[model samples]
Target: MESSAPPSPELRLDNLRSLKVLGKGGMGTVFLVHDALADPSARSPFALKVLDKSSINSHHTNLDADRRARWEIQVLARLCHPFLPSLLGTVESDQLLGWAVPYCPGGDLHVLLHRQVDRVFSPPVIRFYLAEILCALDHLHSIGIAYRDLKPENVLIQQSGHVTLTDFDLSHKLKPKSIRTAISSAPAQDNFPETRSKNRRNLTRWFPAASENKKGLKKAKSARVSPVSRRKLSFSNGEKSNSFVGTEEYVAPEVVRGDGHEFAVDWWALGILAYEMLYGTTPFKGSNRKETFRNVLLKTPEFIGKRTVLTDLIERLLEKDPTKRLGYVRGACEIREHEFFRGVRWDLLTEVVRPPFIPPREDGGDLTASGKDIADYLCSLKSPPPFPASPSSEYQRNVSYGEF
Candidate 1:
């Protein structure tokens, strides 16, 4: 729904020095790059995701990958949230297309999870991270975007110890459904009450049934394919996506069943992410991918000890029925009001001076004294002059979305 173009940048690929390869995925390779033109005495670094046109356009169907790449750039351009990355600049060469965003010195949530003594976060820490993530999702949903992938790997810890979400290639925009239609479409609400007492009663009866034996479960093998597709499946708001997308462990039951899914699928994945953060593993992961999907559709999440508010929240989020999920009707407002987040000061999240962890900043002491040679190299290039002098002119002459 946001049509404004992102501000252009003064930095260019020639002005950046490749530091290291951060990651490789279906969309592109992410590189840790430093501003070559910046004072070498200071570390001016960022992340660059580069897509090789030849690699993406090799096959006819794979052309969709290019579209997804451009779509991600568009998504980043529109975002202005504290927990989301800002699109800094873009590069288009003969074969390579790339974009840049501020780098999070701290690693992703997956890396942080393993660093924990028990490989799981404490309740307080979980509450802190979830609150920020909720705000980010609320912003995304408000703008008609649904982040299909919500795994820990996509949540990068910022230098300030807070978290910022990354990797938007799997995201898609949908029209926001009116409150009445959004609420009425959910069949699970037909007999359900919003009161906590009734909600608890429903959850207690919905816990996994131990009576159902898992020993007799059969495993089925299927052709291996990328789990989350980059194909755009819908163009309107309130429409359902039939495309098979999302990680196996985090995919919603509706997604696994190939039933139409909307924003509710994100709430389901958020539940999966919370479960993994608290338990060190996903709730319904099976021995094989097929079994995992089956479990997603049928099995209920199991808890190790007595029921607690955190588990209660997970249950509400992991509800097999999307319509019955906690955020199904009210978006993030429902999750934010859950008992688990009772003490969170949502308004003061960004002000927290010290979070659970802050990444160690790499000193630029290793650079050559004065670094005059690098500065000279930056002056030698003939790349297009930074961006236009004014915002209005930049917006008018900016590269088209498809061209990027």
Candidate 2:
């Protein structure tokens, strides 16, 4: 599903223009950019994720954060799949680290889900999207990479409306080793149930899939889920992580318990994603972070309507025990064989003439629109303020495209 290829040396920061800010996070910013040079100018606009070396050096988990940023670039460098991203180029300076990849104009599944009737997709739509997502995850696993984060927000739609998984910062490399270590990722405040729900409330929250305009549902600022760490991580062939990571609602029971987890956690999150796609909200949501963890550990997903293959799929995925979860034993191989995906032409997903949803062209799709200098934004983040100006600030990808 993927091949490791070196990035081109010709693509660099100076020739690239940051047209607009696509998204932002604690680690970096994603910008919609196009190459000013003739070669890149021929292609459409792509995304650049810039990480400030200054920012990476300031965090308590600075080592972990730096590793993740580099690892994500490394992951992109090797990826060559229709449902995944490929490295356009990379940049590294004394103060900045960045990389570029194709930009998906269709936004993310979170926004797409909200645009649907009653804020949920039809079964056919869900199946189409899920199939593509599953393929993306399967490809990642095949390369010994586990996609620990599998929320709707991370599923971005291409211009063709097919899905591609983003945000590899939380992804883990799989190693078939049984050895266990005492290593834990990050602090307990971001993972444990003992963390007060009040302070935890503001962090990347599990928003109920609902429209803020529909019923006065209050939509808070979007939060980015943190990563959980473990000394040894693997899946299918028997590898596990003791680290607690993932969104509150989507976190698997094993992860919550700090028990060893692996590729099964991705399946559990997939079940949650499918559930949200079917129903308007996730099945295990609670009033607070503590309650959410409790529900993940103890709650059974409540399903409406009569039994069906789809519901069955979600149930099997939501199994409290990771070992019992669908796709646990065989990875995505088993899940693809399930009845819900019966008749799906898994191999031809990318070749399908018309995907369920194709994004219409917009003004932002134009590559040459005069944009602000990337250096202006890059320099602004070189030195962070004494405190964060706001939870949500804009940023983009960075670095020099040298030999991979």
Candidate 3:
């Protein structure tokens, strides 16, 4: 029997009052909105992502962006995992295309990272966040979707301190490989063997006492390429995507080389995320985009402190060769087994009543009179601000609406 499509969005724009601007981007603006008709004491508010269809069509030459907008809706419709967002409904009109999902009051991982005293998370905190993120990604990959974009901004904290991944525009669906094929075939590589040290520099032996110059010089040599660069290709599951997509810092080496990428690319991003949570910045970041790409292609991540299993996990995930990267063959299973997550009780994550950080409930208010006043005040702006393009905007990922 043919599967029926999910129900259309029942949310009415007129009944929804904008409480605050959450984010805006090329695709559209996300608003923290409340349903005026709902119970005054009930927490019926949600985040509404409104896409100006006309604006998107005008800005981009192709319909790829439009398709991406819809792709997110489709991906959310069937997702029921605790660590993933649920699509409440969608809205469409002559000029707009939008959808609503449960509002996450805890904000995103980026904001949480900055909240730390040193702008970095301790190992325990990193392990907590990464474990939830790993579960979320495992669920995504199981559904045959490759989340091309996996950055701090995309991981939202829930009321309980658990995480829910958002922004699915860059995600891609593929035909899943059969268990037989997956078990029999070795992971593919881009002309590079699992052990890339033979062709590149051998930095595994370098301890904390190693000279900095030697490490830097060797890293610089590994990144040098011929005049010609690898060509980009489109991607599909079990197949490769050639599209040049993803956040620059979080993008995998294969993505930069235009060498087609898959689920493993997300693992590479995970490595970067771990590094940033520990160090307050991406490991391969450079002064400029060009330099950054060069660093990603050739540089080995330098650890400031001593060697630990956490650093080891990052090294394995950041392997320049995708085929050799952690999680390449067994996916999240391989990562979950790493020493870094030695004692994580994966099945009981959601039941943890006291997580590392639980968002304040006051931040998520019901339909109070004050909330109404703020909505009216916001609507009364001389030039009502265009919907906020956040996580989507180049520099607005960190922006948040506190109280209003």
Candidate 4:
């Protein structure tokens, strides 16, 4: 049976006095909401992400989508980091179902990148931001969760210059042993086999099958032949499956090959994001999806033109071979001590400070607006912000890349 559509403003549960649009994508819409219960002096604006129940019902099986949403909420509830958005509350009304998270007035990294398109971030600034992200990822992994989706849109910066990671719908608790086993069993073409195995094993564990054990194992082995096939496996156990979960340009080769992927996928994305921040565009981009996949699979990223210590750091992180990538082999501490981040004081990063870039604030400003406001803000000025238009404008203008 189909569920009812979400509630309109008048029918919403909480007393949201003011709302401003933050952004919109394939998932749904995000709004900055003024929570009546919050102290006005505290600046406690919350982000309300409304899942389009009707859209999910039309495009996907409701139960699976609902479970994914709930799982995201659960993950958010359990996590608390200085650089992580705090989950305020969850609302499940007959008309609408969504969760409320702390609103960051500065918006996401994608917006920041556009605002500073021609400009290059100083090494210290880049190190500061990247370190904070790494710290967040370390915390998530330490707690057994794998943040499968990592991109500029999923990262938010506050007006105070603090960075936080958000959007937990695609994340999952990692089982290292299972992941290791799967990676070890995977073929050579697949580099990050650990991540893929963990996801498949988790699916099998959570949604036990009634099929014969031997058949299930055979089916699992056959599914490992291609990335698309493995993605289908992820969705089969009554879960919402995303064919291409991460941004195409930033996806790791292992993920593209379906050999096996693991937490290292996040690091690869970080490398891409870091490169974009310093150079104004991704190092590797293709004219088409197939070309892009091929580039990821077989091509080495070109770091042509001038070089900096940061360039070498990004190249290390973007390495196609997971075993050679930073953190995977040498670990995070070693990566932190590299020449690119030589002057960085890791302990100081955690302290609240202003970010290097921020959107212009207005008098009597309401950062917590509806989804429309967010979309308008993103597309209003430049739409595509002129970042190496090798691909089509539609691909370039999409700031969130359908992940959020």
Candidate 5:
């Protein structure tokens, strides 16, 4: 937690210029913006999430929207990691509240995946992306935060082509039971003795990560990915969330059951994500939401071919029971050492200068030319900002869990 984005002078909506809408989601609009005064030539630009004050407060329940906006800003202000966004500045006006972070020009993982020949990533590429994502999630967890949202859309690619996570409005701060509890919750240490014996060779017969037979991961171009939600779901031990939240396709079984959940929900979502990346579709996605939840709770993920290390990793991660999930007991430390990443040098992730994709440079060439006032432009939108009643925030809608 140190400041990485160069500090910007105080900014006001009046002085900012909106160049493009990066995305539209349940919370607000993310834009590519520049400070007209700070970067007069607009040589440097950032991503800004703007929320309309009036629209956010329209319905009583919209208070949740307001709280999440502020919460995201607070989280960004406190983060300083290569795979995480750092707050550049903020704007609070009578009509709007906005904050800025580094603009990731390389687009999102979803867009990158579609750019691939089979709309999926190879095993090695998946490993590269997941490793960075794992680090980002681990960093957030280190500070007691549970990231309920873990989808490709939230994974942004920097100009350098490396990934960084965005949209923290759905994240929750958690409290572990105790130092002793954190250390003692090893998933299978008693049964798996690879760390201390020659049995390591046989471990893969029992567990492995993912494998690839599709076209190799290829270079991709920049594209935008919108934000989504996830529930922290644990109401017990002061360490779980009872709230039902998250994209239906990636929601965990406990979340569907409304049973208390904790950090394990994220690992479940990771399983869903890995499955999608490997096969180009989610495992539990049925014709409808009810069917999907039923599949999540009852159906096993169908594999296309013989099991590989990658498939094994997904299997362990996708365990329907959160308590039995691979990462449940030890968090990311457990997953990082899976057979798929046996020889990886984790420390040098950020040092890689080139990745599978690199975004085209902007350098104010188009920025200075666009002078649309951000505040006025946002105020002119025919639709309102993300409020409690907006169609965009589907996670907030009443879910018929009984249908499953």
Candidate 6:
């Protein structure tokens, strides 16, 4: 993937202006752009995301590259939600280099989380954010689209605390036949032949061994001399290869096992995020990639203290058995109704109510200054009293198993 190209002075299109850089990624760059057609006095702003032409042009045989972009545009155009970034318009210039999308000023949830890791949100506040995400997921799923990517970075939070889901580049439109094929595929492997046996061992940790008798003694005996001794087992003989996808820390077991994942995968990632927010760290982290993956496969996450309704909810969400996972059997409605969300009224969450925590502001009293000042102040709290000469290295490493 290529980084987004710097704004081109010669390629300006109609109704688009002032290309201020928002962020850059391997695929493209997002900019804070203005809509020339909108009322100049209007208070709202939009973000224009430009996909790198190099990436789009590099894929010679796959029409999917083009199709994915078009699909995202169509999906965004059809969706109308308080928690979704509205698509003002899309354009392909005469130069034929790139595609552009609207700008979102609220920034992303990942940025906010890093700035306020020390702050603990109230239960209602957490529920409010989670409910909004669920609502967005429901809408996407209803329209036959699966948001393959769901991370704090992909979620945007406005100054008003209203969160909007963005980044449809990785989303896929679900076709009935394809869905059937995915469901019918087999478990995935750990890449190395030596690790194949290790992967199978880990699988048994999460799921019960297939045996006629329920007794543990019988299962232990069966494991020693089972007829099916091969480490790698394919789910479907002719199914397509499993593509490496998703952030490593947030990827689901089903996805890792190559058992054909679905919308429920998003719920698993949400569980990880919720845990991180509550504890100030991820539950399954390790020093290296292999160690982290092994932890995800075999180890159980530790809960800090007294069991609360929220702890129960987190346990359900992080259940190792995909069949018993929070979103799998119970669905989103049931999740929203869990005791942890006791007093939440989903209908009123989008009405510009104040959020639980507001990042501190500067004495200058400018809204723009508030966000930056707060970020700066948070950095100042670090012990040892040192600021890095360069950007943090945390974002440089790959955290997900998925290939970009």
Q: Highest TM-score among the candidates is held by which one?
A: 5
Q: What clash count goes with each model?
A: 1, 15, 13, 23, 10, 14
TM, every model: 0.76, 0.77, 0.77, 0.69, 0.79, 0.65
Which of the numbered candidates is closest to the native, going by highest lDDT?
Answer: 5
Using lDDT as the measure, name the better of candidate 1 and candidate 6: 1
lDDT (Cα, tens digit) per residue for candidate 3, span 299-332: 9998875577878899999999998999887888
Model 2 lDDT per residue over 1-404, tens place: 13445754536667778776776776677777777774444257778887766655456667666787888887877776778887888877777677888888777787766655466765556667777787777767766777888998888877766788988887777763233221211112223334343433210121112121233323222232224554444444556667667888888888887767777788899999998887768878888999989989888887765666677889999999877888766677788778767666553444453455667655554545555557667775444332122112111211111100
* Tens-digit per-residue lDDT, 1-404, candidate 4: 01222322222344553355556544456656655544432255667776656445544467666777777777776666777765677666554466777766666676565554343443445666787787787767655566878877778775555688988877766544222212111112223233333233211122122222222211011110002545433322112223345778888887786655666777788888887766556656778888888988888766545555667788889889876787664345546666666645454443322345443433224433332332233334232222221211111221121111
The number of clashing residue pairs in model 4 is 23
Report per-prediction Cα RMSD to one decimal.
13.9, 13.6, 11.7, 16.1, 11.1, 16.5
- lDDT by residue (114-207, candidate 5, tens digit) is 6656666667667767777877877777667788989877888887677889889888777853431232111221232234333222212222
Q: Candidate 4: lDDT of 122?
A: 38
lDDT score of model 1? Answer: 0.68
Angstrom error at residue 404, model 5: 43
Candidate structures ordered by lDDT, highest first: 5, 3, 1, 2, 4, 6
Better of 1 and 3 by lDDT: 3
Ten contiguous residues with the weakest lDDT in model 3: 218-227
What overall lDDT goes with each candidate model? 0.68, 0.67, 0.69, 0.57, 0.70, 0.51
Stretches of candidate 1 above 4 Å error?
39-42, 180-237, 367-404
